[model samples]
Target: MRFTTIGAAIVDIVVARVRPVLGAKQDVDHIGLYAGGGAVNAALNMAALGGEVSIHACVGRDLEGGLIRDLLQRHHVRADIPDHTLPTGKSVVMVDESGAARAYAQRGASAWVGEQGFQGLDQADVVYVTGLSLKSQAWLEQALSSMETPTFRLVVTPGARQLSHPQALEGLWKRADLLCVNASEAARLCDESVPDADAVSVEAAESLARKLVRRPGQHVLVTLGAAGAVFFDGAQECFHAARPVTAVSTIGAGDAFASTFVHAWALGDSAQNALARATDSAAGIVQVIPANRAGLLRKL
Candidate 1:
């Protein structure tokens, strides 16, 4: 299927084996730079899974921008990056020995894409909007208006960005063909009876999915890391349990799961097959570095 991922593209700086502290220093195991961003990772994941994907985002006219373009091009994802004077957005990620990571982000060019960036958003079979890109209500409106005809499936994953302004994205719950959120985001969107964000269980997933607008071509998929994922439409719910694995880096697991599920579903796989594809794809990604799915999820 033709897939278009809309949002940010960032250069990620990762330092290994460092215990983050305010005033103290720790030994670093390793350091590296990689291409990342919600849009960047999701688009690359689709391309890796054999989907015709394109990325519509913004980047700076700097060295990191060149790296972003090259990385996207290498994976055969058409890169539609708007040029900006600001340095490309970047994230400084610190990882410990146990594979957990903390990141500090600079929006830079990513937050400046604005409405003009939505031009390349059309002509795709599936359009996925990174909720992290909701810096402009106008951009979201442009995206919503594009769905007036319903020619393509609109998938929204409105991470923490939506949580901060739940009212602004209320329209998305109605328009998005599929809504994918982690357990915490779901818990915040529900009424008082829902499970707590800390307790990300099937009950929480189900509760959050039920609160979503019931419309044609609607679905809610909630990812719970090792707890697996839950899929709920209006009628029933399906849960997929995760397989255990030692994680190398948890960075791109969600992107892998989201894109793989969309790819498999677009290929006419049954829901069970799609869920399995997503779960296995996520499991495989955490066992390696470099979130590119070519070596990680392609052969799966």
Candidate 2:
């Protein structure tokens, strides 16, 4: 299965340590930098899992962006990065001892990849659009409309902020083949408050999925953190169990899960198998120190 992921490709400076100070005396124990972002991570995972994947994004003409491009190329992911003058997008991720993270993001050159960047998407079998990339409504709409192939599947993950403007994305959502989101994003789409770590929220998630499935050609998949994931395919409901693992960081787990699931599904795996593989892949990722290792699943 060949896929193209359209979104930001960021240089992530991840600090995986806990310190006492909040503002001034904050001390980090370990700092690791890698090429990362939702789409980048997903595309890398898909490629690592033996799927043909390409990344379509923008990067700055700088050392950091060059390194990121080289890393993606090393993983055999087709890097379709446009040259830009702005610094490459980057994230400062601080993960506490408990694996929770606080991130500060700078969307530099990534935000500049406008409609022209979507010029050659007709060759892809599937296009996964991250919410971060959809921040530019005009560019996203233009890209979606530019698809020349009718068989190209569209998968949309309406990240956190994009859900606030449902009307802006409703048309695209109606055209999407799959819609993936977390419980909070699902709740926001459904105009409900999702409870933290609660079992009852699955119903809310399912409710949101139902509404999304009502849209033509759309299915919904909601990731429920440690509890696992739920999929609504318009006819039935499927739930997958989360793997039990000691997480070092949960930074890119969701992106890994989404890509793995999509990859498995594209390979003709059963829904249960796809979900299981995705959960296992993501669980393995969180336990690893680097958090974005492509071969992390080999350990499982």
Candidate 3:
């Protein structure tokens, strides 16, 4: 299972506490720091699951960048760190007692990845692209065009900014073999508000999956929080149920799911088996408290 993931790498500074949903200021019960970034997290997860994973992304010249690289290497992930002077990406993740989180993301060196950074894509069996590193249409086109391998599978996970540009996203969607998104992103692409306004609803997930699967050369996967996920592969549809768990933080669950799914799928697992594996992995992530969360990229 040779997999390549392209996106930003960030240090996640997480603070967890028991506080009301709305407040001016609250006391933090604990704080934890972890290597984080959409693509990096996925790459780490894939490697942890015994896949041969390589990361194609940029990091800063700062200590945070060093930390991110060290962490990936510790997880046995091959990394292609480009030279950049910008600060490494960073995120502040706050988790309430209810296991819900809000994140403030700052893209630093991640935005500097360009055509020169995408030179090694042809060596991968599967390629993953996230909206985090794709800032412009030119960058997306250049990255995709650089792939010379006819059998390379392309997986696209649109970031928040990419959701605002429907035409550009649709263009990229056509080139992707797999498209994974949350309910909000799916609704944003369709130019309509999702029914029931809940990401975990079957209606919203299935609707979004259907819309994306209709695109040429794309299989759609919609992740529904604790409800698990749904995959639409043209003529067939597959669903997996989430495992019951007491969650401590849900911040990294999506990344965990996407990476696990890709790893399983790349290994030729059926859609049902892949989804089940992904759900179990995500459930393990959500149960870990921030301060006690260690070896996040290690095999379970």
User: Which should have the higher lDDT, number 2 or number 3?
Assistant: 2
Best candidate (score: TM-score): 2
Show model 2 residue runs off by greater than 4 Å.
Answer: 133-135, 197-200, 294-300
Would you list the C-alpha lDDT of every candidate in the order shown?
0.76, 0.78, 0.76
RMSD in angstroms between candidate 1 and the native structure over all alpha carbons: 3.8
Q: In terms of lDDT, which candidate is strongest?
A: 2
- C-alpha TM-scores of all predictions: 0.90, 0.92, 0.90
lDDT of 3 at 86: 82
Pairs that collide, model 2: none
**How accurate locally is residue 39 in candidate 2, as Cα lDDT from 0 to 100?**
78
For candidate 3, the per-residue lDDT at 35 reads 79
For model 2, how many clashes? 0
Weakest 10 consecutive residues, lDDT, candidate 1? 291-300
Q: Which stretch of 10 consecutive residues in model 2 shows the poorest summed lDDT? A: 291-300
State the TM-score for model 2: 0.92
